[model samples]
Target: MISVPVSLVVVVPMCASLLIAVLGLTKYRCHWHISIVATFVSFIASLALLYNTLQIGRISYWLGGWEPPWGIEYVIDYYSGFVLVAITLVSLLTTVYAATYVKREVGESRDLSFAILNMLMVTGLHGIIVTGDLFNLYIFLEITSIAAYSLIGAGKKKGALVASFNYLILGTIGAIFVLIGVAYLYMITGTLNMADLRAILPVHYDSKVVFAAFAFITVGLAIKFALFPLHTWLLSAHSLAPAVVCSVLAASILKVTAYALIRVMFTVFEAGFTLEVIPATEILLVMSIIAIIVGGILTAAQTNLKRMLACSSLGQMGYIVLGVAIADQMAMTGSILHLLNHSLMKGGLFLIAGAIIHKVRIYDIADMKGVGRKMPLTMAAFTIIGLSMVGVPLTVGFVSKWHIAVGALKAGMWYIIPVIVASSLLTAFYFGRVIRNAYFASEGSDQGSSSKAHDHAHNQHGDRNSESRSEAPPGMVIPILIFAGLCIILGTAAFIPVSIAEKAAIMLLEGT
Candidate 1:
């Protein structure tokens, strides 16, 4: 089979950011155009990488004509390939969603900066997915984090700066933990290549140094993943950011952090080490449960629509980690597939929320009453994603949960199945509140819900229509509708993601 160069996935977006700096910054209208084109190209490259990986199995490309153990390599295996496609595809769609949004949220003058940060953020994500070196992963992780910090703060909201700073502090500490872990591993094994470390780290697994490294890495990732107690920064950061920023962070960033953990647990160290030999998997399992329960409860309690969805994201992330903690074949497949499913699901939901904010300027669920009537198409997209999050059948969410349930049973952890079902109900409960508010609750009596709950836009500008039937701009609406369609399409025919996830799981298991 012919080889496909994987670096283009990163190059396309990176170059676009550079181009935007040179030409698009001065011209605000050009930012969205550059972003869309650049992200689309990266998406195409990711597709190529996925196709080539499936045909040839694992493909490791050495950088600068240097071989492994001496140079950084980009490994395109089933796991990385699957993640690459999902990240780039969502990144691309986000640009489509952002086309009209950036104009309103960031304004015309700063459009280029927003576009550059956005592109760089995605470039960092792709780098994390493809890099085979441990230290390289940390660098990419920082790149993504820094870009995210800037993007979150760029919004004109009152606390946007505070939220961004809180995230920067927490995220910087997490990055430090990860860096320390990388250094510890290198000290003993004298290698940074994941494959090389995996080959060399066995005897050291029982040593205190090795265990400390594991602890540091796991703690860092847990913070990044925002698993329950560690999620202090997630809700505000996601809820306060601009629409485009919120969608990308909610739909993509956390998932990639989990993917990085998957790499460390399954690729660099050994699957057996995580699950059987150490307490890591067990701790992950408990944390995953707490994340689900707490996130769901908080989501139900939230009065603000964005905070509710942001909290809900914490719970959904629990499902991904839960599947991996199960570490069984079917469960692992479900876990990996959930990453993709949730990205599409949450991406659609957040974009619709963005649209709601864009057109109606309301964030409270109660204020959304009759708002759906104003934005039928956007609300319809929101409904589809909401039901999916509730694990309704014939949706991608159901497919993922189904596999995980069966995987739980097959692993003799049958009791957890009820917990999964219950979590779905909790999801439905909160989303149901929104649906009722949007469709049934009377909006006339409500007085803007709460002053602190929303961004409170003034004089409602270009994105809104004065006449009857105002909806989000066409650019934003199109991406939401496409993702909504995908929720059904992927759920009904989940064979594609399931098959790829299964292959990735198999490869990881075999390595163990």
Candidate 2:
């Protein structure tokens, strides 16, 4: 296996963002090229790191030659290594898709800023996954949040600015809560290092300060990951933001926040403390159930495609949190697997939404009648990924859902089985509606629907005649197909990721 410093994964993108910012002053037109190259390097580095981690058990790199508990440390165990590869791979694909999507929707004038912020976002997400220090994780979390806010605000949509403002407010509150949690942990343990805190926190587990810290962090991260009721900022931010930005936000950013929560709950505090000490998992389980049902209903209620996908994301997040709350080895494995599965599923869906809008100038689900005939390839990919979201067999979605369901059974929580089934039904209903409109309905069926959608597309792209058949550029279509392919490939080859996730789950359950 190849060897590389874990820090290099974070550094490549960070430095690229700086380079892009500096070059933005010039007439450089290849910002996307730079972004793609940087993300590719980061992805390769992450893959190599994951390979080394699997070989050696754990890989830790100290910053500036300082050891852990004294200076920043980057660690890649099975869990983080798995997540690092998934996020970086998604980042690379999104960058490639954005090459054409951004140029058309956002214009070249703003490409530089978009490219720079995209790299910064990757840097922050990578930092969050690898950091061994609680404070450093918080720092990276804030970095990611800020970049996302800017990216959303940079969108050309009417409510983009307001969406960004709302996310900024909520995200800042979450960050403050996380900071306070870290401060409390440090005050009690005299160390910010996660491993060190894990060793010392057991003694202080009964401390009210520790309980308060866990509460603050859990609530804060719950908000960050958009776990239902707190997911108010996600719909607008996703609906109004640029396509590629939405892709990264839904796919990578949200998953990383969930990862941080997992790290804190299982790694820092241990399963016994999170699951048994205070009824945290019980409370979270209830919240997750509510999120699954409510998010699905909200998704089904949307007329707009982007809004529907955004709402669906809220429900998908529930699946992840549900596994975490289950706290068993199988459930934890499912939770971690869903992190990668949901990223691929949702990321591809958003990209397809962007592609449809880009080609047909339609955002309303009602306006999607006969779109399958126009962009056959794009819509085909969308259908496959949408089915995955519905947890169809032989897709990545079903594999994770199966594991979670069986995990629930293994844990003797049969009630959750019905919740999972109902959520899947809700998912099928909503996605089925779109697929029907796209494939079965007549091409001109949208003629009777509201012209507001047409007016919006007309004003933005100046393309009034959306009846003609068209497809998104190759640059965009290729990435979407790749994501769709992975949904099936990983599903059939389940052991590949399951092998790693199982190990990570065991490590967490054993409190290693």
Candidate 3:
């Protein structure tokens, strides 16, 4: 099979950010155009990579003409390939959504800066997915985090600045912890290539230094993954930021951290060391349960729509982690599957919420009473995703829950069964509240059912006058429809895609 170069994937977006940054100095509008074209092209390229990876088993490309163990390499496995595709597609949709969401949330003058930050953010995500070196992972993780901090602050609110700073302080400490872990691994293993490190590390698993590296890596990633008690920074940072920022952060960054953590736990460390020798699975399992319960209860108390969704995401992510902690074949598949499902589900919902805020200026859930009437398309789209979140049949969310349930039974972790059920109900309660307030509640006493009868009477009389009604702008409507359609399409083909995930799981299991 012919080789596909991976540097192009990373370089394209980074170059675009540079061009946008340069154009930003000239005309802000020019920067937006440049950034959009760049990401769109990158998205298309990612699609090509996905197709190629599916056709070919795997793709490995080394940087600067050096071999894998000596130089940086980009390995395209099924899991990372899927991640690349999903990340770019969301970035593409959000770029389109951002044009509308950002214009309303931020000033036109800041558009270039927003575009630049977005390109760099995605570039880092791509790097994280492809890099075969541990140090490269750290570098890309920093890139993604720094860009995220700036993007959060780009909204220019005092809250935005403060939230960004809080994240910066906490995120920097996390990055340092991760670096310390990498250093410890290198001190003993003497190689930074992940594959090489994995092959050599198992022989010394009982060493105190190797165990310390494992501890440091786990704690550091917990900070990034927002694993329960470590998640204080994410809620506010995600809640107060602009819609586009929230969508990207919710959909990708945290998920990627989990992905990296899984990669390290299952691949870099031997199963004999991680699962059998140490109790990583048990610790992850307990913390995941806590994250699910706490996040769900907190979401029920939120009055702001975006903040509620942000909190709800914490819960959903916890479910993904639960699947990973369960450690059965089906459960691992479910966790990976949810990584895809959650990104699209939350991205679509957040965009719609942002649209609601953009058009109606309504943030409180109470104000959305009868607002659905004015925005049928947006509300209807919201209903589809909300039901999916509740694990309704024929949605992606149901597929994930099904797999997780089966995995739980297979492992005979009967105690976790109730926690899973309760968490599902909590999701239902909060999302059901949104639907109840939206479709069931009356608008107001003045705009009551009787006034609706009068309007119906006026309409029946063939009066030439009536209030105007229209859907959201095409930019917003189109992406919502695309994502909603994908929810169904992916759910329908869930088993087929899961084959790839199974292969990935098997590869990690067998340690080759």
Which candidate ranks first by TM-score, i.e. highest? 2
Local accuracy of candidate 3 as per-residue lDDT tens digits, 286-404: 88999999999999888889889989988888888899889888888888888888989998988888788877787878666655566778888888899888888889999988888
Badly placed stretches (over 4 Å) of model 1 are 1-3, 24-29, 445-467
What's model 3's lDDT at 58?
72
TM-score of each candidate structure, all chains considered together: 0.94, 0.95, 0.93
Q: Of 1 and 2, which scores higher on lDDT?
A: 2
**Ten contiguous residues minimizing lDDT sum, candidate 1:** 454-463
Tell me which of candidates 2 and 3 scores higher on TM-score: 2
Ranking of models by lDDT: 2, 1, 3
lDDT of 2 by residue, 310-403 (tens): 8899989999999999887898899999999999999999999999988888989887876887899999999999899999999999989999
Give lDDT per model, in order: 0.86, 0.90, 0.81
Please identify model 3 stretches exceeding 4 Å from their true place.
Answer: 1-3, 445-470
In angstroms, the error of model 3 at 500 is: 1.8
Q: How does residue 373 of candidate 2 score in lDDT?
A: 72
Candidate 3, residue 80: Cα displacement in angstroms equals: 0.8
- Whose lDDT is greatest here? 2
